[model samples]
Target: MSEWDSGKNDGKPGWNDQPAAVADASEGKQSRQDRKLIDKLVMSMQVEQRRSRRWGIFFKFLTFAYLFGIVLLFKFPLGQGLESATGGMHTAVIGVDGPIAADELASADNIVSSLRAAFKEPDAAAVILRINSPGGSPVQSGYVYDEIKRLRAEHPDKKVYAVISDIGASGAYYIASAADEIYANRASLVGSIGVVAGGFGFTEVMGKLGVERRLYTAGESKGFLDPFSAEKPEEVAFWQSVLENTHGQFIAAVQEGRGDRLADDPRVFSGLIWSGEQALELGLIDGLGSASYVARQIVGHESLVDYSRTRSPLRNLVDQLGVSVGHGVAQYVSEQRLELR
Candidate 1:
């Protein structure tokens, strides 16, 4: 055999045998590299899976917390927890707080309901309307006034008294006039017997801004007292006449309620506010006292039970949201609003 074909030459491997060993070593190294790559891939996948699980758990916990908060809001309300503990003879107190609008806390519906409840209760000695407002809608005040009169006629034994706290004026006083006797603190503001309507004229502003008002109305007076349009003398006069007529009605109602108790001063019905002491002098208020004082002294009952009808928690929440959105919309669309205040 030749030296090249022999397995050994000079006790060392031949070139052909060296090539075979090198191929085997290269194959083994490639196998080890492939195994390391697979292990790294497996470890990377495990780490990603662990991170995803943690994030999923965190999101699930947050969702649970959000649901729990919603439940609590629905369960508890803001300010409505009045219990009628009329074990014996007690005085019924109905709160006429805030504006006296149809949708307000002192609405005619709420006040009438409270009045009826107080009058119907056998343990209630008398009904006291605890008022603290700057006044609002005349229609709402009129409704409450008429109801108080009717209830007073029905329940002749149980008297109805009005006790003004901080301030009671205009429509507030209108309702108070129907009471059997009215009372207020010495510094309380009382009486504003008049009607008013006001709005800003934006015609000049529109002219400066090069804005055109496109108003469509079928009737002649459909767009009466529009803020965007120019004011007409006849329309202004007509609006004034309407206000005077409403004022006349307000005066008549006050006269009928107060009778001879009112003073001869013309300023009493001139939309002027007066202190409780001045109101007493002008016959606007019968006495000077608080709800507690009237309850203990006039009604002869020390125990006072709230008979005010409060809005439900769900209704309050809905109203709050609605008012927030509606208020902005109202300001943008119509800045002019007719109110007693």
Candidate 2:
């Protein structure tokens, strides 16, 4: 029998030796399949290696960029850099804007620091307080006024002027009065020589809503000014006297600052705001002009340098974060109370 037919025919090939050609063809097919599988695995491994390398490079660059940004933010003294950049013979301006309060931009601490820095500059011809504020916080205004006077006395050579932009009233006017000369635009509103405290009475509304205000205090007058409590005539009179005394102090400071320049009008210190022309006529302001006009015409220097202090970005971020967290906690508590109800 032929070698191929010598195999068992039990529905399968025999275990004996097969034909050489058939065996050779089967081995070639199996070798080709093995080669294809190996090639696919190698290709997959190459692709994976390339992807891993690309991701590794991306992460390295990202980490480097983040670190560089941190270095610039924390390691650099940006304030000093700004001061140095303003080098030259120029008029240094410290802005007194917004509500002059402890936490505001126009706070006493910020104004005084800016003034000190401006005055320390050798090339600064004069220091100008560029004011545009409705005013706030008597204590803050007083602190700024005292600092200006002290600085003026300390550096008589460096003249300090006040240039009113739009409005300089109450506490703002108080600060302006300490200047060597007060200038303003013809249309600018100037002067509000007074002290004030404001609040709203919510006792009647709370009573209508059936909301009881449970307040306890050791002193009888401790919670006297609470909006939910009824106004007492005695408390009212005492608060009025306090306001009047504060107003008196304000009038005295204005008089001392303006000296004989103020007019003999009784309404001048009656918390009245006047136009720049009227202010000049009343001697509340020295002249009708702007900062640019004063810098060019009065101080004889056109170059103006701002010495305004600002909170750092990081500090501002931290403050905002804290505020956000507090707000979130308060909101959560409010939601919990609503859920309970």
Candidate 3:
């Protein structure tokens, strides 16, 4: 090989342009380059993180501001037909449009609150309930009914009326009975004055499927109504008595509210729902009319104001999330056994 050629080195000092030293130097330079690239990547990641954090904060603030605005609107009544303290006469309408339960839209709290607000309004000539519900929890209906009675007694000059649109059965009818006058359309369903508790019997089904039912409770009668177990006669009698007492209370309330206007019909409190036309004959309802008709004819005020309390979007979203979680837990529980209360 030529002396200047560094292709193949002979066994000599300083041979092949110190190839070992040259390779070592190149490797050291590559190491430095790698460190620089790593540092650059780290800096880019930090910048991206900061940008993401800023956007997250912005959206959170936007959401909070939106919810705050809704709260303000609800509190201040931002031109949703709210009248001044000295404004002229107008009919105030509060809507009850769902099952009567603690957490439902037509709950006692919402209805009573709306009623109080409508009653407090100086320009309100009268208060009206626009009802469309299949009824629910008797306790919730009782609360609303009691409040209506109290509010009526407190403000005897201001009359409260119930106008049923679709279905006002059971607890809905219970609440409507407290009104000064109950009105329904010709086709509206009006009454189901009774108490009922029901559940399926799964003892035979479990036997057929060869599935075991396991239950643990501290009280002997705690699981009395378990579907997988045979029902005790004493427990059944106790439950029937409870239903009878509740039904008696319902009948008494109706009698007190309707007075002599109610026709002497045993079928009225027999858990049978009746059409508005049939209801009138039975004196379950006083008249046939819509909300508009009540506002114009009864209140003598054409302009109507709605005092219905409604859930905000954010609240509704939270409620939906809770319901989803509750459903999952309920399904898990139902798989174990069918419970009746």
**Whole-structure CA lDDT of model 3:** 0.84
Which candidate, 2 or 3, would have the higher lDDT against the true structure?
A: 3
Tens-place lDDT per residue, model 2, 96-141, is: 8887877677888889989999888889999889999998878888
Model 1's lDDT to the true fold? 0.87
lDDT of 1 by residue, 125-216 (tens): 99999999888888999999999999999989999999999999989989998999999999999998888777889999999999999999
Residue pairs with backbone overlap in model 3: none
The TM-score of candidate 1 is: 0.77
Greater TM-score among 2 and 3 belongs to 3
Relative to the unseen true structure, what is the C-alpha lDDT of residue 217 in candidate 3, on a scale of 0 to 100?
Answer: 98
Residue-wise lDDT of candidate 3 within 54-160, one digit each (tens)? 99999999899777868865775322234334467888988898777776678888899889998998789999999999888878888999999999999999999
Candidates' C-alpha lDDT: 0.87, 0.83, 0.84
Q: Can you tell me which runs of candidate 1 are displaced by over 4 Å? A: 1-81, 315-335
